[model samples]
Target: MPEAHEDNRPLIERIAADIRKKIMSGDWEPGRKAPTNDELQRLYGTTNVTIQKALRILKAERFLEGRAGVGVYVRNERPQTITPAHYIEPAAAGQSYRWLTEASKRQQRGKYRMLEVAEVTPPVEVARAMRLEAGGTAVLRSRIGFLNDQPAELVHSYYPIELARGTRLADRRLIPGGSPALLEEMGYPTRSQDDEVAARPATTEEYVALELPGDVPILEIFRVVYSDDERPIEVTVIAKPAHRFKMGYHIELP
Candidate 1:
């Protein structure tokens, strides 16, 4: 079997990938019409069937959307590029969540819906990350995130019961400014963090929750936030459709 690399991909896939690259690189900005089938066929020196197949890939990935009797166009709501640090801070004492705050700054509507909340035994890795004893349980806060009314991310954050038992974190309602603020007020004060990112095929549940357009890989982030004295306060597992989002990181050197 051939390895899954650019060189080893079938012709149609490579063509689709190149077009995707153009869109991602901003060469083909959102709202712009994609090249016509005839034009794409001529450009790639391929047949209409191949061109159609390639375009279908982009459509399935949501990089393009077609209108009845009209041409395909780049999607208006472009994939979001999230800078982890920007939303890592606890929201101001009485403001909206940092997620909403940052989205407004970008001229977009950020929304959240609480999917579940319960004290449960988490996966072993989560248990280890939260430093809980074997068979220990924690408060789980699961939510689905939206941007411009479209589902964008699913987050499951686990908190130490000591910090959540009497608070909204254990409640099934959405947090006002997110749990980070409550954690701060309780004195843990999110002082630092660790992140582990991975890419894998979407789970059946995640595929349905994120409403992914196809059987595509999803970006999964395992994050642990700590407070003063290196105490872990929050451990979150985030899942987003891989084709519709990217992470940005910036480092400053003194």
Candidate 2:
């Protein structure tokens, strides 16, 4: 017997873990009916209550869904893969609107709504990333991006007021070719970028905006773009539903 099957953990926990492994390994595929409680009880020589408890655990983790009169089954939804190269490599090739381009490649429609654009006091973190003085103002461009009509990400881009004044970045309309192209035209070509990622419970506004499930966490990405001279050109904050994305990176070793 495998050690996991023989461990001293609670029998219900062990049973749940076994079923979870099977589901994840595709031994039991999505939308397939899970073993009935009676069948699990017989196989494990456990009581109905014990089997029920195990099923509850899987349901809570969104691995299974019960149809009451029907039966429990594995969830059909899967996370989408998001590799760093999807954005970075394209940008390196001078392709703008990378997000939209990626969506189109996946046969999904991508669109964005420019929510707001105004000169506002920058958030402390945004100010620090843009190297602005405390309480300094910046041009804020807020947008909501959608994939196949589903909200996928909320992005807020900040630019130094002096750099953005009278520029498309300060406009309330969608900029053709994206902001990067406009910045390049203004002599601040992007040279490099840094990204910081983290996960946390979604805020109320985020939950509503992304139409996310209760208690689901969100992936937060802070990206800072710099010019050839190392002057910060832009800072963008992105919020995405955690389950909707799987971030990846590729690096070469020295």
Candidate 3:
């Protein structure tokens, strides 16, 4: 057994780690039902609540899944194999977020559903994320993006159009282009960012766009991209069917 952490780890995290070890070591094979809560409590010497907490973490990480009325089981695909951990840098082929954002606003070859595009007063969190004063006017863009007529993803993007003057973003034709690239072209290049990813249930819009059944789960990604000058510019909330999309990243070690 590995030495325990000097600091007490969260019960869920510790349980999650042990379960991950079993899966990685092939002690638990894909599609195999993990031990029951009572069994886990015995094995880990913990309470049902602790076991549930751990299982929830695994579920969120896509390592395991629960069926209604059925017990938890290892995912059909090895989580490591299906979970996206790599990011691919698109060819420096001149991408523009403005154009993409605008393109998304327009109806292209793929089917689309615009939830709402009303100018509204942003909440404090939105204002903080966009670096704008609270209650300021902003454009709320919510739409379902599709490929081959299949719902690929749902995008909720907020922009400070009040600050973006003399740009194409206001025109709403942004497509096949990237919003980050567009900002760069408009003299507000995105230099760095913070992002978070987790598995979640489909919202009403997501279900309609993805044609998702009640049981199907979706992946949610929250991204905030900013400029080198430390100014916040874009906050995008994305939702996609689990198997329909993949996230890629490339990291270099020093």
Candidate 4:
């Protein structure tokens, strides 16, 4: 350990470095319990707060996880692949694969609350993407998605109004279960969807609506759905909390 200094490095940083070295050197393995605060205090002669700071740093670095009631344990393995932004094709469509519904679990951090829905004039971008005439009206569905009961994602879905008009679906409050499965039943099959991911700072609306931390980045997903003729019919934008969603994609190489 370097000599204790007053000005330069933080105690947590130094301790984190030492712990990292031990793991990198194979002194500790995956799934191993990290030294508790008491153990760390004994080993390093540090206070509980200092040890906790070090552990929190390691956890943010993906080196450890706390199991609620259980002790902090090392991650068993790093994700084999980095999450990628990709399109999802539903099975009823010609696409061979559908996203596993089993994998899509609702998080309690944010409440999935619908804000509003109404027939609105489609914006130029939406018109072009959905192949609708300018000045055409579409059904807009807006919702606030929460994590840990905290707002996290602001979701807005637009569909051609004719398809959804006169139906109770036009009212956001009338929707149930948070999934738009009714569209499929209406015969406008969602064959496939295209997703685009971009990194950017959160806007003020996002920060407040999603209840995001100031320093955390946001993952923006723009998804376009195509119909049987390959015409884009719907557009949905998902503003997700940075640390919450683990996106992944796979590609087959010949």
Query: Each candidate: how many clashes?
Result: 0, 0, 20, 13
- lDDT by residue for model 4 (1-254), tens: 99786746887788988886666455777789887789999998889999998888777756678888889997774322224232243344332212222124321222467788888886676777878876888899888764445465687888877777876568656343222345665666667778888767788878778766434467887778877788676788778765444456776899
Model 4 residue 224 lDDT score: 88
| Candidate 1: pairs in clash | none
| Tens digits of per-residue lDDT for model 1, 60-91 | 88888989899999988666687899878989
Q: How would you encode candidate 2's per-residue C-alpha lDDT over 1-254 as one tens digit per residue?
A: 55665488999888988987777567888789888888999999999999999888778767789997999998885567677556642243445487788889999999999889999998899999988987899999999999989899988999999999998888899987688777877888888889999999988878888888545578999999989789998999999988567677888999
Off by over 4 Å in 1: 1-6, 68-70
Candidate 1 vs candidate 3: the TM-score winner is: 1
- Runs of candidate 2 exceeding 4 Å displacement: 1-29, 38-64, 67-69, 89-96
**TM-score (all chains, Cα) for each model:** 0.91, 0.78, 0.54, 0.58
* Poorest lDDT segment (10 consecutive residues) of candidate 4: 94-103
Error of 2 at 75 (Å): 2.8
Off by over 4 Å in 4: 1-111, 174-180
Full-model lDDT, candidate 3: 0.67
Candidate 3 stretches greater than 4 Å from native: 1-116, 246-248
RMSD to true structure for each model, in Å? 2.5, 5.3, 8.7, 8.3
Determine which window of 10 residues in candidate 2 has minimal summed lDDT. Answer: 87-96
Please identify which of the two predictions, 2 or 3, would achieve the higher TM-score against the true structure: 2
TM-score ranking, best first:
1, 2, 4, 3
**Candidate number of the best TM-score:** 1
